[model samples]
Target chain A: MVRAEGLTFYYERLDEEGNVESKKRAVDHVDLHIRPGKFIAILGHNGSGKSTLAKHINAILTPAEGTLWVDGMDTKEEEKLWDIRQDAGMVFQNPDNQIIGTVVEEDVGFGPENLGVPTDEIWKRVEESLDAVGMLKYRHHSPNKLSGGQKQRVAIAGVMAMHPRCIVLDEPTAMLDPNGRKSVIQTAQRLNREEGITIILITHYMEEVVEADHVFVMDEGRVVMEGSPRQVFSQVEELKKLRLDVPQATLLAFELQKRGVRLPDGILRNEELVDELCRLKSKM
Target chain B: MSIKVKNVNYTYAEGTAYEIHALKDINLEIPDGQFIGLIGHTGSGKSTLVQHLNGLVKATSGRIYFNERDIYGENFSMKELRSKVGLVFQYPEHQLFEVDVLSDVCFGPRNLGCSQAEAEKKAREALHMVGLGAEYEKRSPFELSGGQKRRVAIAGVLAMEPQVLILDEPTAGLDPKGRDEILDQIESLQKERGITVVLVSHSMEDVARYVDRIIVMDHGEVRFDGTPKEVFRHYKELEKMGLAAPQMTYLMQGLREKGADVDADATTIEEAADAVEHWLKSK
Candidate 1:
């Protein structure tokens, strides 16, 4: 659903006189392609340009050089801006910032209403979107009164109401508690699995990325690694060098391997690790 | 030096239609020079309880004693209490306002009526403690990275030389490496200074790795309080409260459930690895 070719973006630091003092490349010569209806994760440290790259998907920030296409439409095309945004709805880090309406239902309906969807269709979309995110029961509750996870689900519903082909969640779980994080991640997974919506999740948490169909590790404004979850997480040392981390289970499995226990690489989940250990025990 | 809370209850908008009991009859004792993890889900009253420790929010009905002195007693100095009990708020980078990093760190000590030289000395010391050296002194706080800006904000609080430091989700938005750097700096600073450190966090792995004691709050009450292993043993209960044990704990439990002989109480990665190796050797 998304493709980029040598995408380069830089922020110009202006001096006192409005002249460019220096240019800092936030995303440099990055080439990546995200297939339709797949769960994708982008991992990077702070200021590593992951967010800068994600902004290009929704046409929020245009590339200074090279090009990015969302669903085959070039993001730099002004006429395609709104359509590109409609194709890839963006959910930001802070739920409080994205949510604008006082009530949850009203908030979810705002997007469809903006698209000039009829009032009846808008209400219909709101119900379906909220139901998809499992927030329909809270339709009338004040957005401020909801928990962080609930508020984020409402935010996702707002984006889903736009009928985007893909959703770009930029660190959506950064501010959430453990349960909140789980709920949000599960919501994203369900949207990808059941709704066939492409999910591009940018996050610092490694656990959230383990289940993704593909993973991209970015550092210093470039894609340092790209592969399946298992393939990427197997290189624990490389990920660490990029200032990222593997999931705890994977780390534990790696440590066991170091200590002379025969364990497979990139153990993504707790059950997988347990099963592998048990299989080893059976051999013993 | 030490803090004691007795029968503390806090209600927001009391006597109004929106009255909500944020905290309920909370009781605890924090001895000096200890690392404590204060954990709870959002709106679980962990923040409310920490605010009470530093006298930022007064309990509706309770008493607090700091260093054997009743904080609510007549002639008690709230200002003195504040300086001694430093609070580093969430997204503290937003609290940075001074023109330069050094000036920002010095703001706290200077406000406490220290001479300029003394304040600069304290600021430099605090900056060094947070791993920011003189090379960062003249740089504007606004120009620093997210992690650096957060460190400067923490330095602002540390400059006060507080005996008790309370951090509220200090690593909320930071990346994995940045989170580790900040937490490690705090850990070392706590050990060197021997000051009581209360880290309020949502990451179970961090709390298990760093703090000596874990206090679990739920519904405005202390649900569980013990060492990491002790509290994480109640992971089922924690799950019900919108919390969880570290991933290693779950892995250990999963191993045991699958009929493998393993210590399920292991909370950290190192501990779990040791347990698994021991089991493997026995086989």
Candidate 2:
């Protein structure tokens, strides 16, 4: 439920006298439309403007040129800012920076409570959100004592308690270990599938994007590519040139194809690559 | 030239209600000039173990020896040990407090008693090694991009010219290209200087691609210690421990399970491709 048209944002660099010296365009003229309940992934390298684009979705930064609307509410309109943010919640990379409450249950409830949700209803929403992220058992425990994965789940629960229609995770798994990464991605997927919540995941991890409904590749502040996972991953060389990566299985399949092996492109999963190779072996 | 850990046991908040055993009876022997990958899930004691290597954290009970001399010995110089075993921590950019990139890199050498001129020379060399040229020397550390900032932080450690370098999740939060750049620099530096390098990371692909040895830690103990191929052979066990082998390992395993005449021990994409091609030709 997010849309953008010619969305452009620039960071102004001021000189010694406080005069604007130059402007660096963080987000170029980019267009995007995210349907409700769709799981979308945005991939790019450092300084590629993917994070800048994510900020626009939650009204954290308004577009310098053109327009952005979340749930049909224009982000530029002052009165609609709060509504826009409520509709699209944002989760950043660092859990420690986002998590402020001492206790897990209190952290999850803080979001809804700030939205003026009733005390009793806040607790109810807290329970549901924690349960959704599979952290209900830790509701009473101190968040500082939890592991990185558990703490991230608590952060997601906090966002979920706000009842946002869309959730934008900006590299939530960057600071996590392998298990932590898997758990957080699974939590996002479950919310997308069972709760019908729109998911906008921005990450450098290609494996995480394999299961996304739609994938958008950004570079130099522009949307260079946008398609289904298969369509985007099929261009291994292009992705590499853009300073991004494909899944390891996809890369292996691409290498084989380059060596004159008759294999299909864009093999996302290990099993798919194995099955394909086996089929080829049988033909041989 | 070597680091040896003997029955190291580290406990946090000892004798308190929150006492936690951070490290078990850990024993490890690191020889000279080896590229090592240290991996574990969150709170698995990888960080704690690395901190012990450079004498940052004292073990509750046990001994550590660097260059065959006990680090805990009264005659041993902890400052000297720290200089020789440089540690680039997680989020190392947070340690950058100097105004400019050059001065930031110079801090470590300066702290080690190098004169300003000597430190500047070493800092410039270190910056060049990390691929940051002289043009970036004058820029503010805060004004640089994330990757550049990370490189400057790394250069801060490299300027010390440590015989053993330990990096904890150095590439965390970086893009793929940035990750590759930093890792390649570290690998080359290790090779060129013939120095020991221990990389603590969460990415299986990275460890598989670079390290000569892989040490898997679980519950404050070393669960597996061997070469990448050897350690990754226990992929199923790794997964159970909240860790995993590289995706290539799984692909090879999947191929073998599907009755393809391919080896399942390949840990890298090139190796996996070679195995599949060999199998196809044989067929």
Candidate 3:
């Protein structure tokens, strides 16, 4: 659903008079592609340009050089800005910032209403989106009264009401507690699986990325590593070098292997690691 | 030698239609020079309880004693209590406002009536303690990275030379590396200076690895208080309150649940790895 070739974005330091003083390349010559209906995760540390790169997907930042296409439309095309945004809905990190309406249902319907969707269809999409995120019962509650996770789901529902083909969530769970984080991830997974909406999740949490079909690790404006979760996590040392951590189970499995335990590589889940240890114990 | 809370209850907007009991009859003893983790889900009254320690929020009922002195007693100096108990709110970088990093750090000490030289000296010491050297003294705090700015903010509180430091979610919004760096600096400060540290965090792994004691709050009450292992043992109970144990704890619990002959008390990755290895070898 998305493709980028040598995509370069430069953030300019503006002088007092609005002249560009200097330019820093936030995304540099990165080649990336995403298949429709697949869950893709982008992992990077702060100032590693992950957020900068995410902004490009929604045409928030036009490329200073090279190209990025969302669902066959070039983001650089000013005329297709609305279309590109409609194709790839964006959910930002802070739920408080994105949510504008006082009531939850009204907030969600705002997205569809903006798209000039029919009034009847807008209400229909609002209920379905809220239902999808398991927040339909809270439709009448004020956004301020909801928990962090619930607020974020309402934010997601707002985006989903736009009926986008893909959703790009930029660190959506960063501000949430563990339960909120779990619920948001489950909502994203369900959207990808049940609704067949493509998902691009940017996050700092290693555990959240384990289930993604594709993982991209970015550093210094570059995609340093790209692979399946198992393939990427297996190289524990490299990820650590990038100042990223593997999931606890993967790290534990790696440590066990280091201590002369004959465990298999690329253990991703808690059950997988425990089962391997159990099998080893039985053999012993 | 400590902060003591007895039967403390806090109600916001009492006697009004919006009256809400933010904190219940809570009692806590925060001993000196100890690292404590205060953990709870959002709106669980963790923040309310911490605010009471430094006298930021008065208790609706009950009393608080700091260093054997009742904080609400007549002749008690609120200024002295605030200076001795430094509370760093979440996103403390927003608290930075001075022209330079040094000036910002000096703001707290200067406010306490220290002369300019003494305030600068304290600022220098605090900055060094937070791992910022003299070279960064003149740099504007606004120009620093998120982690660096956060360190400067913490330095502002540390400059006051408090015996106790309380930080609310110091690692929030930071990347993994930044989070570790801030926590490591805080840990070393607590160790080297013998400053009492109360870390308010949502990350179970961080609390497990850093703090000596964990206080689990739920519904405005202290549900559990013990060492990390002891508190995390009630992971099932925590889950019901919208909280969870560290990932390693979950792994260990998962092993036990699946009938594996492994101890489920491991709270850290290294401990869990060693436990699993030992279990395998013994088998």
- Which residue segments of model 2 deviate by more than 4 Å? none
lDDT of 2: 0.93
Per-residue lDDT tens digits for candidate 2, residues B1-283, read 6999999999999999999998999999999999999999999999999999999999999999999999999899999999899999999998889989999999999999999999999999999999999999999999988989999998999899999999999999998888999999999999998979999999999999999999999999999999999999999899999999899988887777777768888999899889888999993
**TM-scores of all models?**
0.99, 0.99, 0.98
Compose the digit string of candidate 1's lDDT tens values, residues A1-284: 99999999999999899999999999999999999999999998999999999999999999999999999999999999989988999999889999999989999999888889999999999999999999999999999999899999999999999999999999999899999999999999999999999999999899999889999989899999999999999999988887788999999999999999998787899889888999999898
Candidate 2: count of backbone clashes, pairs at least 3 residues apart or interchain: 0
Task: Tell me the native contact fraction for each prediction.
Answer: 0.88, 0.88, 0.66
Best by DockQ: 1
lDDT of 3 by residue, B1-283 (tens): 9888999999999999989898989988988899999999888998999899999899999999999999999999999999999999988999899899999999999999999999999999999988999899999898898889999999999999999999999988788888999999999989988999999998998999899999989888899999999999898899999999999998887788878778889998889988887787773
lDDT of 1 by residue, B1-283 (tens): 5899999999999999999999999989999999999999999999989999989999999899999899999989999999999999999999899999999999999999999999999999999999999999999999999999999999999999999999999999898889999999999988998989999999999999999999999999999999999999999999999999999989998998888788888999999999999998894
Q: Which DockQ-derived CAPRI band holds candidate 1?
A: high
If you superpose only chain B onto the true chain B, what TM-score does each candidate give?
A: 0.99, 0.98, 0.98
Q: After superposition, how far is residue A107 of candidate 2 from its true place, in Å?
A: 0.3
State the DockQ of every prediction: 0.89, 0.87, 0.73
To one decimal, what is the Cα RMSD in angstroms of model 3 from the true structure?
A: 1.3
Which candidate number would show the highest lDDT if scored against the true structure?
1
